[model samples]
Every structure is written in structure tokens, then in C-alpha cells.
Target: MSDIIRRDPRAEWIARNRLHPLHAAMQPAQHSWMGPNGVIRKNVHGVGFIGPNGIKRIDRSGAQQGGATKRTAAVEVQLPLHQVPSPAFYINVVPDMVGGRLSSHDRDLLGLARQLAGSDGAVLAVVFGEHKESAFATAGVDRLLVLEGHEFDGYSPEQRVQGLRAVDQQFNPRHWLLPDSRSGGGELGRRFAASLKERPATRVWQIKGEECIGRAGAGQQDLARPLPRLILAAAECADPISDTRHEVLPVALSTALARSLPRIEDLGAVAVDPAAIPMAEAEFIFSGGNGVKDWALFHQTAAALGATEGASRVAVDDGFMARDRQVGASGTWVTARVYVAVGISGAIQHLQGIGACDKVVAINLDPGCDMIKRADLSVIGESAAILQALIDAVQTYRSGAKRDAA
Candidate 1:
């Protein structure tokens, strides 16, 4: 037996090394085995060593008793700075009703500033209302120029132009980004461009590097080129990235300069229609077409659903809805969360306006219509009946929810 065992390489090696039985146990075994000490052990493929009690489980209570350890420090992301050819300025025109808070479009202007200036270049923001340093800092604005005095309180077109002129004379920014919005931004941009004797590219939707792209003329041709001295960017163009913070240099306005500026007669506050909400700002839009009858009931149903009323070009042309409420290529573009089209035939122009809508619901008598095809959900029925049913269902759900909450 000794001669035969000595001849075997495995037994000879084990004998020569004088290895312990526990050392052999540590090797990957097929299954669990009891050792000399009556301890059952196993070497699992993925799992670490399992003791006699089986796989050791982490005890939550024990861990809680031990308390938490210190967390690792956050790693900072370093971005390379770019050198801009010239300074860029953002014009922030505030309305009194806004309570000094920056609008979404205003924030977009800041985003544009960051895009233009990058990490090193200075980005200036010129505002007419109350200046919030923290807000501009969060927006990555390098400098803040607040226009003070009663003349800058409201949306006075002439007063705003004078304020913009003051900033222009001081900085002489090569690129000026203005909001291309319904809240007097478009009008202001046009007037500013005319005053400066520079053609402003309006409704600009994209800014790649130093170039700006947007729709131009009645045909709405795609216009893309090196950014002009002035640009009126649409709200959808630059999404606000509030991730970075910057130290903003505050600039003091000269009281003498502000006083000496030509002042135009303040057109007293214009009355606002409570029922009318701009399509761009509306969260939910209920649009009607020529196929919709009982226009009054249609509008009432919209009000019941807490949706802003919109209209197809045909409906507006037929005098069923106001021209301002028209949703099409020639009309205001809406980026609502939900858009309900009642009796709308889904013209290409009409569909273009609702392109940004998250969910589209179409109620049309024609099953083969484009609206039905494009809609997330389509209901084939009479427009009037469908709208009334939707209104009733929504009201019932609301009442039920309220009762449950109570």
C-alpha cells in the first residue's frame, strides 16, 4: 500500500507537503461536508464561504445598531472653457403681473447665454424688474444689469427700448438673444431690431455653436446661418439647464443716464381677459374644427374640463372661434401636455402646432382622417356627444375623488 501510494503523484505531493484536512476543505468542493470539528462548510460557485448555519445573511437590525459610516466625497465634473469672439447679452422683459419671478422663456434666455458664453466667456442678463442674484447665479449668468425705477415697472414698449439701449451703449454686445414669445417679446424684438438698424432672426428654434436656425417669412422657410447681431429665440429652443452655479458680477445703473433717456407716454395697463390663456402657456388644450356644432356648448365643455379653448383654421375662418385661438402653421404653436381635437380634420398645419403635445385625443366622425391616425387615442363618434360624455366623466371622477379624500 505504501509503495502504490508513493507511486501516485497526488498522494505523494499531499504526503510531502503534510497539508491539513481543513486546507483540503478550503478548496472548491462539489458539496458541503462536515469537518473534524463537526463544522459543516461549503464553497459555493458565486457565493463566498457558507458556514454550518448555511449562507450568512446580513442582519438589518445589527447593521442599524452599528450606525452608518461616512460617505465618499462627490466627484466634480470639469468642463473645458471656450473663448467667445464677442460678449452676448440676454434681454429680460418682465410684466408686472409676474411678481418678479423669471418666466420659463426668461430662463431659456439664460440657457442661451450659457450656450453662447461657455465656461470662460462672460454672459450678461439685462432685466427690467426686481433682480434676484441667486436666480441668475443658478442660470449660469456671469453678470446682472437690473433696470431700476418706476418707468421699468410694467410692459411699456418705449421704456423697455430705452433700457435696452442703455445696456447696448455700455456693453455693445455682438450677439443679443431676446425671447420670441407672445408676451410682447416678439413686438419688442422687432422694435429693438428696427431701432438698432439690424435685421433680427425671429422664432429661432436651434443654436448650434455660433449659428442660429429658425423659420423666416410667410412661407416659413428654414433659415440657418451664423447668428446675426440680434436673435429672437422661441421658448422651445433653449431648455433651461439649472445645474451649474456662477458668481454673478452686479452692474450699477447710472441714475443720470436713466433720467436723461427719452420717456414715452405710458399706455395705461391693458385689461386682460380671464378666459383667454395663450396657447403656449396652456397645459391642456381642447381644439374644435368646422365639423363642431354648438360652439357655445363646446367652449363650456372646455371650461368644465379646465382646458384652454383652441380652434382649427377652418373653425376660425368660419367665425366659430377667435383668430387668436387658431391652432395651425400660421397660428400660435402649443406645447400642451394633452390636446383634445373635436371635429378637427387634422390638417398638416393643425398637426404641426400640436407636435409637442404629449398625448393627443381625437374625436372625429371620419374614421379615416389624419387626426384619428396621429392621435394616441381615437374615438369615432359625433363630436358634440363625445365632448359632453368626456365632460360628465371628468366631473364625476373629480366629485368621487373629493368625496373619498374627505
Candidate 2:
């Protein structure tokens, strides 16, 4: 029945088994290439997405600018992760104000996820919040696990850590990804790395290898494990220029430094407060800037306000105000309900620190500056005159209230 003619015994055997004559003479292919169990194998891995802010639709086009605060996350299929034949991916769902809405930062993260997903595993999502009509109904996830609780509301660093640790324990993922934000992402990333004794690169925009080594021997790199996790914290703003010869070079340097060290430690818990950011619990905020003119004006303004007066670094250099209360990137990060910026040009470096406030009032002679643009209210005048008037007004208001109560 078979198209074969028997000659010598070995020749007949080779002919019957469909083996090439030269290969048979040398060695058998199955014994050399096949596994002991006659099967080829590869390890499976998982990637996790920890979204604290969550996804929301922010309309930055300036046309009726508004967006709903909701949390939505998505995963994409692509390179190494997806291509690995049996990999898994998960999304850590924290309360996201911006749901499903892709900001420039979100798109960058998503792009990386998709590029790395190549057929290795299925991407899954774990959402935390009340179930909605269409919460985890995205295309990427193979299955969605919805966790419900009030702890998901707002940004709780401790709660997030617990949730992520739980996910990692259950899923056993090789990589854990975090989106960089002002709130608490960086601190969490560093803490996780330090706690696990694992090497984590934050603000990572791309990944090169997802290979596994097996087991680390002395300096031989950790193998036996799947692969190194890539954590990306894409910057919402563009990178600062690294030029020192220009006029704005100092500001550029300051911006670069801020980017390099964005994480602010919990100064209270730490024994030594190196950053020297003023405590937010100050009753009186005596702030100074270019407007104070000189050191005498600084004291005069502080006395007039009956508050702690401070100055900008420029003021400090010009011998106008003290080193403390200099609120900017290099200076302290203040959170006073009432913040006054006198005689100061609102540089981007300065604004980043104070922008998160209840209300901000600007007092500047040059009304066209950026400070005026970002302030809640702008008073166009000299700092000395305004300070006197404000002091009088505050005193009168307090006296009137006391009298009325009597």
C-alpha cells in the first residue's frame, strides 16, 4: 500500500519512517529536539495596570469645557505580552474621575500597553466602584472583576497599596504598571519597589525586553521569574529644554529639577524635613515676592497683615524677604485657603506649587502677567498700599463680628 521498496534493513526502516537518508545516518530529530514528554513549552506572564485617577472625558478644546468624573480603563493586544501564547494582564481599578477618556498622558500609556501585548496572554481588568450600566464593558479585557466599596472613593494611598498587593498575590503578574500623577503615584511606586526589593524604573515610557532568565546566581540577574515589569509614568507636559545659555535657562533648570524629583515626602512622618516646604496648617500666611521691593517692605507687609511674611527666591537674593515662605518649585509648597502673590510674575515653575488651592488672589502692578491670568482675583496696585488696606479691612471685619455677637 505504501510507496516504498525494502532493500537493506536500515534503509528499509528509513524509507518506511519517511526520514531523509543523510539525517537518519547522522541522528534522529525527535530525540534531540523534543522535550522529555514529547512537548515544547514556554512560561506565561501577566501585566497589571494600576489606575488611581481612573479615566474621564476631559474636554480641553476650550469649547464649553466640562467632563464627567468617572473611572474607566482599557487594555490592548500587541507585542511581547500578547505574543507569549499564554500571558495574562490586569487593570487595578481605583476611582477614576476621567473614565475611558484618553488624555495625552493616557494615550501614551495605552500605546505602550498595546505595543507590548503581542499574543502572549489575555489582558484582564479589575474595576473598583459601584457597578454601572457599562463600566468594564471594554473590548480588551477577557474578563472583568468588579470590586465594590467606599474605600475606592478619592485617592487613598494605603487602600490602593492593599488592593494592588491583593491583585498581585492572586494574579502573580510579572509586571505592574503605574500612571504618573501629582496625587500619589510616584510615592507608591517607590514604596512598592523598596518593600519588594525589586528593581523598578518609574516614568518609563517604553520597554525593550520581557524575557525570563530562570534564576539569579550571585550577579547573574534574577531568572526562573517571568520578566521585568515596566512601570510608565508618562508626563502630561512636554520635557523641559536642557539649555543653560539662554535667559530663561535658570527657570528651565528649575523645571528639569522639579520633574526629576516630583515626589514630596510626608514630612511629618519623616524625622528630618529636607524639602523645607512650609506646613499647610499655618494660621497666617505672610507671603512676599518681587512686589515687596526691599527687606523693609517685607517686614512692613508682614506687620501690616499681622501674619508671617515670606518672600520669593528673587526677593531673598535681593535681600527683601527671608528664605522661608518662598513658595515655588525650589521653595515651599503651601496650601493656604487665602494665598496672596504680591509683585510676583507668575512663572510656570511657581504656579505648579500653589495652583492647587481653595482661592488665590494676585496683587501686581503689571496686571498683564500670567499670575493675574491664573488668580481668582487680581488687584492692580502696589503691595504696600494693598497690605495696609487688607489689614484694616480684616481688623474691622473681626471687630464688627465681635461687636455684633456681644
Candidate 3:
């Protein structure tokens, strides 16, 4: 063999495509690099290679490299902590806390509150019952008040409003902010405003100096009004706080809250067929594509998972699915919490449609497909096999639960 250097285009392409299985092996070794100060910095984790003596050896000259080397530690970036020792006033925020965590809407509401709070005022987050969220500080909350009790759990908007009223009495916040979403925030905000006799700016999307802008009358016209004491903000109202962290200091109401008689009874969620739900409003979607050879298995899996069915343009055009079941930029723009794409090659239009989805799980035989590149999790296999595995796992889990109940 000649001792000449050569470049392999295949290796270069694999290195660039992160979704390729061989991408990791194609990465160049980064043991040392010139620092910003012009000094050579050595990666401690990438120090030495295993020598012939079956021991680790170090060669600063770069000959004895790549042996017994461990992966470099990922650097954790910490934002600056923002503290308010004493606040002149408060900007209280009531978040939906969907699924016991702060959703994107909640973060947007908190961001709006942060802007309203400014320097002298504190951003106070008022949460109902218990929550699993742990990023209140980073979400721009200067103070947190949790109203914990069974009364605040489930569908208890009346109790939630009472708690908010209690917060109003104690804090007398400069402004109150809530997400005007279908997930309870809109109703709760309206009720709270009615209770306080405050005319709130509803569906507000933007807030300038002294005026607020919102959608009104079937969302066909924009309504501008003077910034009010209460606001029901729409989604994407303002960017979420990312630059700085807040104190998240714990606060409490001065007096015990007065409980209001419940007008609504708490009933657990009712199971409904995913087919009846609209694609745009569906929280979980299982979409199929041309690669899906077994349509029956695809439908079975969707039904078992209680997920709304969607299809790529190819599937819809081929008459495997209805036109309304299509999902993409050309079809319905879905903002599902979890979108499962089976055998879909992920056309640009399809990817664009699910842009706002929180998570995308792709099952495809081709690991290098665009769907795999965009997926948060990817399973490289026949879709039928993967669907069967998922169904079996779910059945096993349910059987165990039934046995435990007995």
C-alpha cells in the first residue's frame, strides 16, 4: 500500500449526517485545542491510549492518543441568578400547570409577567395544588406561592378563583397574567376578572408601552386597549425567559383562604375515541406513511394507544387514508404533545406541519431518513414489528395492573 493521504467522501458524508449509524465512528478525535488565550489546552478525559503493555500511556507529542480515552464531559451552562431582596410591587401569574408541569403557555405567561414586573416589582407564580415542575426559578419567577389542598385538585375552577382572589387580597399585584388557552386558564382568568369587577384584556398577544393588542370577534380583527390590571394572554405572548434565573423565593398568604362551596363536581377523565377528535386539537397523533405495509396493524396500534390517526400525503393520495387525516403544511397544522410517525420518510411539508409538537417519535427502516433526523426518538425497524412490540408492552403493563388490583 502507498503511504499517501487520501480523503474519503463517504466518511465525510457520514460524519455530517448525525442520524447515520456510523456518524459517531466518523468523528475526529479532539484531544487538544488552542484556547481563546492562545494556550494549548489538553482534554483530561482524552489524555492517553492503551499501550502494548496493557496500561494507559500519555504522549504529549500526540503519538500515544486514542487509548482508554473517555468521552469529554458536557459543560453545563448556568444563567445569572436574579434576586429581588425587596419588591415594591408584584406581578402575579397563574399558570395552567398542565400534566403537573409548566407547559410552553405557562412559560410564555411567566415571561409576560417578568416584563410587567420590571426592576422594582417581583414576578410571583401562584400554582394550584401540587406540581412536578422544578424550573420555576429559571422560568423568571421571583416568588412562588403554592395553594395545596384536595379542593384545588381535578376540575375545581371555582376553588382556583377563590385562591386567586386570596392572592389578590394579600399581594395587591400591579398586574395579573394568565394564559388564555383551552386548558382552564381562559375560564379561570375570566372568572377571576368577573369576581374582582376588573375588565381584563382577553386574548392579548402583545403589550406595548401603555397599550395591549389582542384578537377580538372571531379572531378576524385586532383589539387595542389600555393595559389593564388583569390580562388573559394568548400563546406566544412574549418570549420565555432564558438569559437570567430568578430567586424563586417561597411566599405565603398572610391569612388562611376562605373555601367557596363547590358548584362543579370532580369527575375523572372520560375515554373518547381518537377518531372523533379533530387533528388540529389532538394531543397525541399516530401518523402513517407509504412505508407502512400493514394498514390494519397501524390502525390497531393507534386505537390501542388512544392516539388520533394521521397520514402522510402519499398515504392520503393513495387512498389509504382520508384527506382530512393528512398531516403536514399542505394539510392540518398540528401542535400535538406527542406525534408518532411510522414509516414516514418525513417530507418537508410533513415536518413543517408538526413543527410545534413537543416530541416526535419516528419508526422507520431507513435510519438516515429525514424523519429519523427530526425525531426526538427513532426506532430503526419494520413498522409492523415495532407496533406489535408496543402493543405487547402495553398489554403486559395493563395485565400487571389488573393483577395488582386484585
lDDT on C-alpha atoms for all candidate structures = 0.68, 0.48, 0.85
User: What TM-score does prediction 2 earn?
Assistant: 0.36
lDDT of 3 by residue, 256-306 (tens): 988768989988889898999999999899999999999999999998898
Quick one: how many clashes does candidate 3 have? Answer: 2
Error of 2 at 347 (Å): 7.9
Model 3, residue 137: displacement in angstroms? Answer: 2.8
Q: After superposition, how far is residue 99 of candidate 3 from its true place, in Å?
A: 1.1
Task: Quote the lDDT for 147 in model 3.
Answer: 95
lDDT for residue 50 in candidate 2, whole number 0-100: 20
Better TM-score candidate (2, 3): 3
- Steric clash pairs (candidate 1): none
Q: Which stretches of candidate 1 lie over 4 Å from their true place?
A: 1-99, 131-134, 217-220, 258-264, 276-406
Model 3 Cα shift for residue 90 (angstroms): 1.3
Overall local distance difference test of candidate 3 = 0.85
Please give the lDDT score at residue 97 for candidate 2. 21
For model 1, how does the per-residue alpha-carbon lDDT over 96-171 read when each residue is reduced to its tens digit? 1133555556666666656666544577777676654356566556666777678666657777787788778877
Ten-residue segment with the worst summed lDDT in candidate 2? 243-252
Flag regions of model 2 displaced more than 4 Å.
1-159, 166-175, 179-184, 190-199, 203-227, 230-287, 293-310, 323-340, 346-361, 373-406
